[model samples]
Target: MAVERNIKCVVAYDGTKYQGWQRLKNSDHTIQGKIEHVLSKMTNEKIEVMGSGRTDAGVHARWQVFNFHTRCQKSTKNMMDYMNQYLPEDIGVCQVEDVDLRFHSRFHAKKKTYIYRIWIGEYPPVFERKYVHVVTETLHLQKMKEAALLFIGEHDFQGFCSRKVKKSTVRKINHVQLKQEGHELTISVTGNGFLYNMVRIMVGTLIDIGKGTLTKETITEALDTKDRSKAGERAPAKGLILHDVSY
Candidate 1:
């Protein structure tokens, strides 16, 4: 009988160039496609990896979790080293562990945290260009904080989600906070799950509030109305990052 095994891995990637996490027939620049390519080459067998969630194109990840089943008897270290050799420089496998066959990275995740970075100065530092969003206007941190507070708790975030989402828009937000370090502003949000473009939309709404484009009351009204147009625009994907996921 063939031995079955499962492996869980923590992955990080600079998603500046990739099309996203999922694989597409004609796209060769997806994170999943790159990882699966390296794994297939190393094991000489095709394998499908299950990611904790799908991140949109140009969205970076700091602690994305994924799992795959394998029949190889190699040690985790050996596999990790071999995979690194074949994987691109932008992607890194932080850790790997042997797991039971029943482990599913996506379904078992309890919470996910995402961070959106904005540079609130005239220009961003050259070194941080790929990771941060540059905003020329001065932001009102107090108003942004007030808007973020309204996002906490369960709500039907239909207004914040993009039209492409096929699933229900109801989601529970555990925490939402806005902080600033010099010219760098960070919006961190933790939740059970998020709808398509939800995080970006939230960030945009906060930004609109800070810029005096939208008021805090508008957030509650948008949520209550479930009107997509009432919310602010979706922020750029380059500013969003998957900070972590807890299982």
Candidate 2:
């Protein structure tokens, strides 16, 4: 019998039309499902691909990684060409490489960065509507920054995560910063790991602070209490993007 080997690949996808990165029953329009379908067709076998993490519905990824085991010894370039030819226009395999048999994309990741975009203007920009969350109300960037500072360091982020998450809520947030360029506000958060909806909820709470609806003290209280209701609304999925994952 021939020895099977593992192949690792980096991918990027525009998630405007797909239902995030995970595959679900009866869902043929998810990013993972679509990729697996094409890979299965190319390999002539049922190929199960594992992603580094799942991005929520309508969320986009600039660089995401995954791995799969294969029996055939095919060239990376050939596999890349075939994947692109069969994959939908929104998803693209950026690069392919042979990896160790024991390597797992999710477990090997060192950190992940997510960016939540906010458009604060009277009229939403036509070109960026698909990527940014439009908020007509003016925002105080300084206040948002102050609130963001409270999230730095390791903490049990139960309040910032959705209740649907089953994993441990303790995550180390390496940095949280808010930047503003014109009417665009970007919240970039780097963390060791995150729970479901963590970044989006954090962005929502900061937006609330910007709008004067929430205070810096409230953020501290939310973290201390570990209560979900004390935090701001969960921002829409369309505004959240997985910027990059580092290994």
Candidate 3:
């Protein structure tokens, strides 16, 4: 008998082509759907892969975790190799490990970090166009940094999310930071969890502040009043990358 075993996988993908991480009922062109289809074909049985969380369309991921129960007899290395060989070139299985049956990727996740990249040069980047958000205006790094600090700590982020949320908007932001190297600025945020478009909206607001379009009061009012309109623009999805999910 083929014994059921739990398998954990670390996935990395360039989200430029697909419709994000989750499966949509209407379309099968999704990351999860692609992986599931391949696995099901290889195993000759229906297979479902669960991810830590969903990444919005056009958002990339460096380390997304997922787990599933399988009866495939391939060794861990062979499993990883099989996925890499069959999966699309944009998505790759970084590693595969056998885990306890109780390991649930989403429920057991500890924290997730996301990074947004912005290009400050006037001329558009030639090669990195799809991977970064290019800002033509001069940005006030100090002002943006100050405003980003306010996002640190727990607060109600009702205004930060874009979806029709039924759950509480309160979430903890463990850290907020910005690092500039030449014309590229990387905005990194780590938190217990994130609302739909939370990171993208935050980045947009920060960019507005950097450009002197938005003020400190804007961030404060959004948090205090829980008004979505009080927040800044939601940054483009391509600039956001799932840095990692820590468990």
- lDDT on C-alpha atoms for all candidate structures: 0.91, 0.90, 0.92
Write the residue-wise lDDT of candidate 2 on 59-143 in tens digits.
Answer: 9998889999988667899999999998988899999999899989899888999999999888768998999999999888898
Give TM-scores for every candidate, taking all chains together and pairing residue i with residue i: 0.97, 0.96, 0.98
Backbone atom clashes (below 3 Å) for every candidate = 0, 0, 0
Residue runs of model 3 more than 4 Å from their true location after superposition: none
- State which candidate, 1 or 3, has the greater lDDT: 3
User: How far is 196's C-alpha from truth in model 3 (Å)?
Assistant: 0.5
Q: How do the residues 8-38 of candidate 3 rate in per-residue lDDT, one tens digit apiece?
A: 9999999999899999899877999989988
Per TM-score, what order, best first?
A: 3, 1, 2
Q: Please give the TM-score that candidate 3 achieves against the real structure.
A: 0.98
Give model 2 RMSD, 1 decimal.
1.2
lDDT of 1 by residue, 1-247 (tens): 4588899999999999999999999999999999999887776679899999999999999999999988877899998998788889999999999998999999999999999999988765688889988888878999889788899999999988887466778899999988899889999999999888999999998888999989998899889998889999889999999999998
Strongest candidate by TM-score? 3
Model 3 per-residue lDDT at 159: 86
How many pairs of residues collide in model 1? 0
- Clash pairs, candidate 1, are none
